[model samples]
Target: MKQLKFNIDSKIKQLFQYEETKNIFDTYLPGMRSRLESQKGVSSFSLRKVISYSGGAISESAIEKIDQALQNVIVYVDDTEITEYTKQQPLTTASAEMKAEGMYTSIRPGKVWRDTEGKRIQTHGGALYYEDGIYYWYGENKDRTDGNCTVWTWGIRVYRSKDLYNWEDLGLMIEPILDNPNSGLYPEKHVDRPHILKCEKTGKYVCWIKQSGEEACFLILEAECFTGPYQIVKENYRPFDWEVGDFDLIKTEDKKAYLFMDVNHNGIYGFELSDDYQKAEKEISRQYENLHPPFCREAVALFERNKKKYMLTSGMTGYIPNKSDAAYSDSWTEPFQSIGNPHPEDESHSSFNSQISQVFQVPGKKDLYIAIADRWVPDYPIDKRRADLIMRSVASHYEPEKYPMTEEEKREIMDRPMLEDVNTSKADYVWLPLRFEDEKVYIDWSDEWRIEDYE
Candidate 1:
């Protein structure tokens, strides 16, 4: 973590290295920000000489004062050396002392997590399913060069782990249906919130994804093996009559599986899964139904603690992180009572600046639960205030008049080609330990953590 020394003779352009040095120039050369258009030529000159070119705008005394201040400034930088904020680099997985090979010692949230092959892991918005002694991680694969757009579905990316930290890339278990344009897996379709359930009765694995495209519904797929050419069990199937966004699937203690989903932008509901785990059995209960667009929810994540069912839902802000709501019920099929935002002081502002994806209990730990969230579009400019985001797709659905839009206007919003693409390859994942103090779930911001830390 060595920082570069602030060299006085270095070009003025290099002053963008850190805030301390940059502030020195900003304070001394008041008009320096106005000359940003000519930064390239200005960068060619040393800081000591830039004063001469400033045409009386900057004085020699100001430069010397800047020099005095920069002498104590060390430029914190990244390997990329790009003019951006400092990024956390993943810890080396090569430590032989690790109990599991390729095991990462800490869960570095909001950091670049490289896989065994020294490539970024693409798993996101997916749950950890534990079977036998191994845990399988499944999520959308954003590693595709298909323009780095999330709307295109590559497949359900899969990885396996003996320890939660060390993961082996298993590639795409469910390949995209590239041949059919009407297929939910088409390049234009946005597949999100993938969840896998293992049915012991049938001895098969069920993979379902919330796909929004030609058909806005859950695309159900099943496979005989975990790593598979998962064939479609159902296509364009809407468990309810609405445009669904994100969902979560959980198999309960009674050998029954329940589906918790965002019923369009209206409310959050729970449905029972059929015996084969291929389709939704029936609508069991709906909560947050009374909430209008202002308080509407999406990205439903369900889990059980001490036989009490808990649910987490994020506000309906597309790609932008929002405050997450926590609720609990006596049964998975029952309506949950709102527990409000469960994040602690630092994270209470905006769910640790990450949206809830899923909350899962660590293997072999009865009470230890982990709240997995995605810092989606991490660098996208937005805040916790939902009132400020009128251009968001969900906002149009909730209130068409205040944010009026024609049919074509609505379709053209998220179109990558029609608009400037916000490539999501740089998106980050936020994994925090969820502490249940009595009935409340709290997530404190942790820059880096390990599962063993809980044990």
Candidate 2:
């Protein structure tokens, strides 16, 4: 195939007319213009050459495959300016002011969230476990620069919060075993969707992780405290020999724990865990059948409201947003009826362009729940050298800036080193208050909302 070379700098300058697009480019690909300028004369190369020049910063094979898929199309610079960049609204300042007043603050979805120490909360694809008036949040810690799923460096991270607005980082609960290739905690092996459940029978906190390797399974970890130095108990906790994907756990009012996972990316499957939360004793699907269409659903966020069990799942559109479906049942083992898109009519059909991570019930409140979703940033190109050109056009028309921090201000805003793979690493949480009325659930989009509003 003939190689194609497009001038990225000129293209960005011409295309990104509005400040929003420029800010996005600068946020995700910091110092990209200078880097491209330094290598301007040598920038014209094939996709493989670009990936090779990235030197582990990008995935070479993925870019080559993508380039092949595009049939190596050539482009010419045009005077047409992108108009989508003009839609971004200014950041909402009400939440910050509420925080300053020490009042119950609102949940601002898709914005950078910091802990008490002012560090970005690194938890993604995680669950909230409420215990003794405290909430513990645990999830995958993607602290690496590559932004590709192929590179897994850190294990699960834990954070604690009281009002569900301000979080305090509890550090990594399950640290990666960097040197142990045979261990399930190996750095390169993909481990995500960490859910913790306190076993009623044993009174021990158990964590269930979706381990993606040769044979995907649930790796069980046990710890005495919510903030844990957890130890792996079972490496392969498979109920029906199906490979596990994203998952969630729920304990019924009767004190029975059930495990929910996506089997082979097919559908959401339910398994009843042993009373001690150690084994996947029974496959609930044997009686209930698969909850949704095979290979159509993942990112399971299961919860219960008004004695009705509900599961919120996103269509299997990797890293891109799609419509979310909700299934509710009278019982965990019963067939769930599909409730089409629970979001408001004015909102994006794709659940505000985010995927449901968890739907958590408010502690000490009945029928009150919060729908947690991740507003995924655009996927970074596998060729870091071509990173500026990959998502520049599409990202111009998305969510408006929240705080409107400049690139330099954003870098100085945090105490810790900012996430390197800005595209994917900066994925922010979208927590919206979920309401149930007349047997239907509604997730309305709010720029900023206080927890006290629901109360």
Candidate 3:
């Protein structure tokens, strides 16, 4: 056997750091080679190595070490040795081929959550429960190999995180129950928008999910654990007969619980949940016209700021971006004023480029709540759809006598942090500051932001 000497150039060294380049080495080239070998049905296959370019013009000693690395992979066949550099070129080429076919989109653009390694978080129209000292995140496991977001075909997945960044998969919280009669026509009956709460008096964990349909139903189910082996509790369990929109629950200081939703599909609506949350009391409907958008609003979050009440609603765009509109009032009911889209310029704000999957009011942080979103990447590889969860802080700074938002403020709000350009690639999480005025929290997206020290 003859030894082959092969060298590498600096250009190839840098390309190795890129996933797109390495994915070529890892996934595509091997798949192609495997398929080709199987079709041949042969024990060994050899191809002619016709070199088009070869240069030993080493300008640096570092290049020489790189060359030695390449030489180790060189092969000699029929007295013709293939360079190590040449062998790597095929893998690089294969990666390009697979990427051009959209194989790495799913794995790329991972979510940003401040200080957390977030590969397992997918809060898709899901819910969060603040339990004990930890926050439990539960949502649809769209991180599977299905690659489809149909009304059916997915189940709830759960994870627990202490600081809302690093997550440990607790397995599927809600499994697909095909045999259940109320589970709709197919096992794939979509389970969207999950919100969890702990009953103040009973200390029970409750989750509310929005079922799929033209006229949607919001089902409030209770479980013993935040990541539930959830069982459907009757009574207030079914709101199928009513047209319910994005619904969220808020507990008053008095230990009374209230459920809020988009009423008439135009504005905020509220109803008191029974002590057991089995059902909302009949004739308990209250509407607020001015607090939310009259055109289109979904994904609602209820927050209290400076002793005032505010309701946040996001526009409906379904995996596409859209503007977010909010409103607030002293009372949960009427006289609510609409605070127009907070991030009109954010390409991902509308529809959140996904949707307001869940709003987690930090059980640990005082006067702090985090709005959770899923950044949908429909073009991901491996039949898996990926979503990025974003957190923004809402604050209140307003004089009730004055309008909730001024014209100048509205213009400035959307202009900053261009969503298309906002760097989420390396950002673990983002904190958008909001002000509380008159009782409601107003969220304004900020690129340059800082949190004040409480101590």
Candidate 4:
């Protein structure tokens, strides 16, 4: 690499404010930051990029500052303009680079869904959207330059790609405010697992997330753009004002929105969102207590399969993966039946020792569904905190059945260690596939064994 000769010093302040512009300032700041910490004695620096679709004096002053800063370093708007005086290289914007990968390398093989261009982008508890032949993934980026993990200071990270596989980090979609009341300065107000739903009426993006601290009020927020400077739409407790848990939203054919959340005793509850997408309709409250072990189940995924609706729930053990359960109902609310765990022998309670994140559907297929989870790496600090998002497919006609364990299996279950242990006598983990009498959709684990056979 050629080191550009410039009279500039590299020890200048880093830009921390969010500005909507692409200028030389953005390009050289990272390098300036690098040089500041380098063995070289460079002391100050500045750079900028062009701002598209805007014309203002503030923008002009921005350009002037760039010219002055480069009085000592070479600058170029394009590669051909590069000369000894134009020393710094232009900034590179993110573009898709990989194929989409589905969850579970051992299961339902599909295209790759995520990638980290050259940076570690951990947008977990995120959602996916398809627009203009491209997919945009939004979530939290927990990686920080400092080794210190700021207890409640993480920002929403965005990544966009043409095919789900090669992702380019779009930077923070939602950031923590040190002065705002909703800021995660305390442990209770932290943001977790944000899901986005585009409003049909207003053409805006709405996000719902679990807010910890001060009693875990699950909040709903909105922004005009998918990559947002999102404004607070409404901040309230769940319908009953109970501490809301991980939740997901789905749209009915009629465009009506429904939110599925973790209800009392680790069960599942859901209700319709008002026309504004800010408040929940009280009359629509529906709860299901029979989906799996009532112990600490939190994250939920709701969607329609073969014209019928289904939900998947995961046990709450924090970053650790657990045995998860899937259930279905003909109606959006009411009378849901459990489909049991896909893996009954794993210690995490799931097939591959993973935790559920969200469920994704193949764009054109109604019966096709993929369950996503984060297979967290242990003890890598924040590195482990950012787990690899995984997905696996389920059979179209899957159904859960009552378990009848053999005597030997029963004995082994009695000798299990922890309550979350797969071998525990709680046969809830020992699920069997169901054979539905009707022609409705069914998802069976044993017969669905081919989930791991996909290439």
* Overall lDDT per candidate, in order of appearance: 0.70, 0.64, 0.48, 0.50
Pick the winner on TM-score between candidates 3 and 4: 4
Off by over 4 Å in 1: 1-103, 145-151, 381-420
Candidate 1 pairs with clashing backbones:
none
In model 3, how large is the Cα lDDT of residue 427?
22
TM-score of 2: 0.67
Per-prediction RMSD in angstroms?
15.9, 14.0, 20.1, 18.9
Give the candidates in order of lDDT, highest first. Answer: 1, 2, 4, 3
- The ten-residue window of minimal lDDT in model 4 covers 388-397
> Model 1, range 1-455, lDDT digits (tens) per residue?
44677756765556664577777767766666456424333443466655653447756676677777778787666644431112322433334422333448789888766666656677777778887898888887765522322245456788888877777888888766655657777645778778888888888888888986336788888888877778888878888576776788888777899888877666788889889898776888888886665468888888888788899888765565667789999987688999988874752356766787889888788578888787766655344343244234445555657666555544333231211133454557888888888888878887888787766
Task: Supply candidate 2's per-residue lDDT for 333.
Answer: 88
Q: Considering lDDT, which of the candidate structures 1 and 4 is the better prediction for this target?
A: 1
Name the better of 1 and 4 by TM-score: 1
Q: Provide the global lDDT of candidate 2 against the true structure.
A: 0.64
Point to the candidate with the largest TM-score. Answer: 1
Ranking by TM-score: 1, 2, 4, 3
